[model samples]
Target: MNTHFSLFRLPETFELDNQILEQRYRTLAAQFHPDKFAAASGFEQKQAVMMTATLNEAHRVLRDVIERAAYLLKLNNIDADSPEHTHFEPEFLMQQMAWRETLMDAKLENNAAALTELAQTINQAQTELHRNLQVAFSENHLEKAAELVRQGRFLQKLQQEIHAV
Candidate 1:
């Protein structure tokens, strides 16, 4: 599979070194910079632009835990974001409801402190899911990984809601 990890010459795993990724991204960005291809033929310039876009998207997906998990699921022939496959565990569904209620209450009360606390809680949950996702992928548990990806997406959306608050 020609994944972002492949593009960076790295193994396809959840564990990645941020520093190394940053350095590689910079190096690749420089080489693919559209300006570098300006003096080239029209076809070459177009190809450079397309590669640059792909590089940028790869960098973004590889850098974000949630996005990376989803991408990996896709690589495994699973679409984690598919609406028809929305089957979250009951416990998680209950927690999601509670979190939403808490967010709603905080918004109504204009409680910035509560919102901040909620964001931290969601971040911690995201971290745990990230860890679990790594383990799932390592064990070749694609189904579990897909579930975690969907859960992470929920928490990510909650985080965005908190930010909007």
Candidate 2:
């Protein structure tokens, strides 16, 4: 029942780095996927099902940019929960808000050109932010990376909302 990342240890053959994490995910999934246990006894099948779910959840949280940032902060004993001031500049937030508002208004007006531009802008921002995140993580700047992740998560949500509209 422990949700702590430390409790999610890799197999001895695996490691905590990104590549090993993915490898472990695949290995566990191959063994624990429901399809792989279909002919097992009821108890064995249930265990496989639970293991599969846990493996998927672990992979999801570990692989995601935002979640990985938060996890890294926790590992370093930083207060990553301070979303208000972790990594983003005010100007960046302001620009994001303006873009979101534009997207909202454009959706209402059914402006194809506006939508296209907005999409491109968002994509470009994402690319830059991803690079920033990589640099921050590599340099052990969890605070900075956390900020980029926060912005990315917000932009992703905004993109989904716009698409839904």
Cα lDDT listed for each candidate: 0.91, 0.72
Tell me how candidate 1 scores on lDDT.
0.91
Candidate 1: pairs in clash: none
> Candidate 2 — what's its lDDT?
0.72
Point to the candidate with the largest lDDT.
1
Question: On residues 1-165, what C-alpha lDDT tens digit does candidate 2 reach at each position?
Answer: 354354356431111477867776777688678988788999999998888888787788787766766666665676556656555688987997899889889988999888888887887888787778778877777768667767888878776766676
Q: What's model 2's TM-score? A: 0.74
Clashes of each: 0, 0
Worst 10 residues of 2 by lDDT: 7-16
Per-model root-mean-square deviation over C-alphas: 1.2, 4.4
